[model samples]
Target: MKYFFFFLFCLLIGIISLTAQSLHFGYDISGNQELRILQYDDDSQSIPLPLNPEPVIIIPVPDGPIMYTATNGLEIYPNPVETELIIKWDTQIANLLVKIELSAYNAKLIEEVKFRASDQKAVLSMSQRPSGVYYVKIYCSDGRIINHSIIKK
Candidate 1:
């Protein structure tokens, strides 16, 4: 009986797939900040299925330098972000410690991430957190410190 129900559920999903749409996010594999997109058809006979109708991005990823280093410079964009945030440096960094501090009327420690710098760029997701001013500090193994302020909404 359980197997029968499971089969029926999958069958229903398959029927729904005919009308569902699929979305694909483009990532730069060459380590450069270039965006390209490729999609598959629903009739694909592969073991793992792909997006049904293929996703169409209304906004395109603008071209620019994707990587940076701490020595050359440090920068943060779109000050306030919900899901993800990008950090760029101009020089090669070794040990990178990222600290996010929240300060509005008062300052408080929110989160901290210690990572080895790679590819000159890093993305952080902040789906959680309140709207306000955030201080992101980057500390390198060479004893250099860089800071950027972000606002979350």
Candidate 2:
């Protein structure tokens, strides 16, 4: 009976821990002076910031011919997106104006949107767009500009 109780206790603890959410911590290097924590709803994959002393996380330059970086705390995910694309940034710039431009490979402008930085995240729908390579340009009110290439399938 004691062994059974011990097993039940351990099982309960394991279940609780397994259901707990995980947080990712990283420093916002965009002169925002903010700490960003990323939370995911699902457990299929998680990319945590490296456990290092440096507060900034430097993403490797993309293999494409053109690459651009605007300070830090800027993240675009699910490269080669299917239907939707997510753009995330630090909350510190939430009050500033952010301009996002989407263009085709031939420099044909597709869509443009402007919003306050506080939104932090933007979900772009590509359902109507054709499957091809597109360019994303982010113009921040703080004189910061970032360019990235994305593929839609």
Candidate 3:
């Protein structure tokens, strides 16, 4: 009787595990397996506070909205500029005329570059600039504008 109960318990456990696996993973008619992944919506997009001393910059994926901007297809890098600053955008906005302006903390315009974003990238030379707070303003032909702060070391 003891051995029969043990065997029954083992079988029950096995069936429970198989049921849980089928609930979590799907099998197709052709015997192909597919996993259902959990997805979060745009409103839940946020950066978590860093646990380390180093700062973290969360770059939104192509599907998610860009930070601090309504537009979705732009990328900037190296916030604490050392030599050069690079700005890039999606090809969808490549034909739009883009005006990139760099300014000082006091709202003084420093340098401006106007061109078609078809090139997909803009490189600004900051090697000659003084180390201080600065701003980068990008204006798109679609009437979208984004301003970002850059710290020069």
> Best candidate, TM-score-wise?
3
> Local error of candidate 3 at 37, Å?
70
TM-score of each model, in listed order: 0.41, 0.50, 0.51
User: Which residue runs of candidate 3 sit more than 4 Å off their true CA positions?
Assistant: 1-71
Which structure among the candidates has the greatest lDDT? Answer: 2
Ranking by TM-score: 3, 2, 1
**For model 1, how does the per-residue alpha-carbon lDDT over 1-153 read when each residue is reduced to its tens digit?**
999999999999997775554544544677542343343456653233343555577965344323334445665665668877777555434334444233333546655653446555667767776676677766554444555677888
Which parts of model 1 are misplaced by more than 4 Å?
Answer: 1-71, 94-105
Which candidate, 1 or 3, has the higher TM-score? Answer: 3
- Candidate ranking under lDDT, highest first, comes to 2, 3, 1
Q: Which lDDT tens digits does candidate 3 get at residues 51-107?
A: 243557996533321243426677777889899988888887676645888899998
Q: In order, how many clashes per candidate?
A: 5, 2, 0
